[model samples]
Each structure stands twice: as structure tokens, then as C-alpha cells.
Target: MHELGIVFSAIDTLEEVGREGSLSSISSVTLELGEVSGVVDSYLLDCWRWAADRSDLLRGSELLIKAAPAVSVCDACGRTYPTVEHGRVCPYCQSADTELLTGRQIEILEVVAT
Candidate 1:
């Protein structure tokens, strides 16, 4: 799955960060996940556990994910609402003229070193 690729990419990035900072080991990593990013948490974690253990700096490191809510802004009403609930339609104005404001990102927010 793509989760393995994502995990590998994250680990590569973490390795670069570690090398830049001369870190011996990483204890944890906190990641921010968008609600509509389409990455499954269980798959990500499983991939993380498998791939991270293969890295010297990331073996046993914890991967913590925080969910970010999906938001959409309505052009007709100039209001923001949850994208998951109402989808492309604006709840207040019942208009389809809406754009996604957030919830399509995956970012690493924090890293703890040992």
C-alpha cells in the first residue's frame, strides 16, 4: 500500500533531520493527519512499526497522529463548515459553490529524540 511508501518517506526525512542535528536516536514523532487525506491510520501505524524498526535511529520510536478536521468555505454564504458532514454543498445556503479550505495535508509536527 501507499502507507508503506509514506512511512519510508517519513523515515527518510527523519533520518535527514537526525543527521543534520547529530541525533543518536528518535523517541517519538507526532504527525498531523488531515481527515480527508485518505491514509488509513492502522495501515500507517503498521507500516511505521515495520519500517521504523528497520532504522537504527527509529527502532521502537512511537508514531503519534493527530487528526485535522476537514473544512470547506462556501462562496455563496461566505461561511465555513465541516466538509465531511455536508460535502460540497453548503449547509446554510444550499449552494454547490464551495471550496475546500483544509484537510488534505499530512505533516510532521513534532519529533522527540533520545
Candidate 2:
């Protein structure tokens, strides 16, 4: 699954950063997930747990996830609405030209380490 890849990549980045900073252990990884990013947070956390235990640096590491809200702006009305609830339809003018303001992203915000 793609979540596995994402987990591994996150671990790899953490390991690299730890090496650069001489950190011996990692406590947790905090991630910011978009509402419409097509990523399942539970699945990603499960995959991360599995992958973390297999790595020396990440063993016993905790995964923290924060859900980000998706907002889109309507071209016709210049109004913004939650994309997850509206589904690309402008709540103001029912316009199709909606531009995403946020969400649709997966990013590592921080890593707690020692």
C-alpha cells in the first residue's frame, strides 16, 4: 500500500535528520494530514507502527496525526467553503471553478527525539 511507502519515507527522513544531528532515539513523529488528501490516517499510523518497530532508530516511536481542514474558494462568488462537505461545489454560487485553499496534503510537522 502507498501508506507503507509513506511510512518508510518518513522513517528514512527521520533517520537522516537524526544522523545529521547525532540523535540516538526518536520519541514520536507528528504528521499533518489533509482531509481530502486520499490518505487514511489510521492506516498510515498502523503502517508506521509496523515499520518503526523494524528500524533501530524508530523502534517504540509514537505516531501523532493532526487532521487539516480543506477549504476551497468559489470563483463566481469569491466565497470559501469546506471542500470535504461541499465537494467542489461552491456553497455561495454553485460555481465549478473552485480553487483549493488547503488540505490535499501529507506532511511531517515535527519529530520528537533525544
Candidate 3:
């Protein structure tokens, strides 16, 4: 799955960050995952457990996931609503003219070094 590749990318980034900061080991990493990001949290966690142990900087590290809700703004109603609940259509005015404001992102927020 693409989740493995995603985990690899995060590991690479964390490794670089660890080296830059002169960290010997990382205890945990906080990741912000969007509700509609399409990347499964369970899959990512499983991949992290597998991959992190291979890296010298990330062995036994915890992956903390913070869920971010998908939000969309409706042009017709000038209001924002949960994208997953209402989708492209605005619940307020039933308008199809809507824009996604947030969500669909996988971001690393912080890392704890030990």
C-alpha cells in the first residue's frame, strides 16, 4: 500500500531532523492526519512499527495521530461545514459550489527525543 511509502518518507524526514538536532533516539512523533486524507491510520501505524524499528533513530518510537476534521466552505451560503458529512453539496443552501478549506493532509507536528 501507499502507506508504506508514506511511512518511509516520514522516517527519512525524522532521520534528517534527528541528525540535525543531534538526537540519539526518538521517543514519539506527533502526526496530524486529516479525516479525508485517504491514508488509513491503522495502516500507517502498522507500517511505522515495522519501519521505525529498522531505523537507528526511531526504534520503539510511538506514532501519535491527531485527527483533523475535513471542512468545506460553501460559496452560496457563505458558511463552513464538515466535508465528510455534507460532501460537495452545502447543507445550508444545498449548493454544489463549495471549496474544501482543510483536511486531506498528513503532517508531522512534533517529535520527542530521548
Predictions in order: lDDT: 0.96, 0.90, 0.96
Candidates 1 and 2 compared: the better one by TM-score is 1
lDDT at position 96, candidate 1: 100
By lDDT, the best candidate is 1
How far in Å is the alpha carbon of 30 misplaced in model 1? 0.6
Q: Which tens-of-lDDT digit does each residue in 21-102 have in candidate 2?
A: 9998899989998998888878998999899999888899899999999999998889999998998889888889999999
Off by over 4 Å in 1: none
Global lDDT of model 2: 0.90
Question: What's the TM-score of every candidate structure?
Answer: 0.96, 0.93, 0.96
In candidate 1, what are the lDDT values of residues 6-110, reduced to their tens digit? Answer: 899999999999999999999999989999999999999999999999999999999999999999999998999999999999999999999999998889999
Model 3 error, position 24 (Å): 0.7
The alpha-carbon lDDT assigned to residue 53 of candidate 2 equals 96
Comparing 1 and 3 on lDDT, the stronger one:
1
Name the regions of candidate 2 deviating beyond 4 angstroms: none
Q: What TM-score quantifies how close candidate 1 is to the native fold?
A: 0.96
Q: Candidate 1 at residue 89, lDDT?
A: 98
Error of 2 at 106 (Å): 0.8
Q: When superposed on Cα atoms, how far off is each prediction in RMSD?
A: 0.8, 1.2, 0.8
Decreasing lDDT order of the candidates: 1, 3, 2
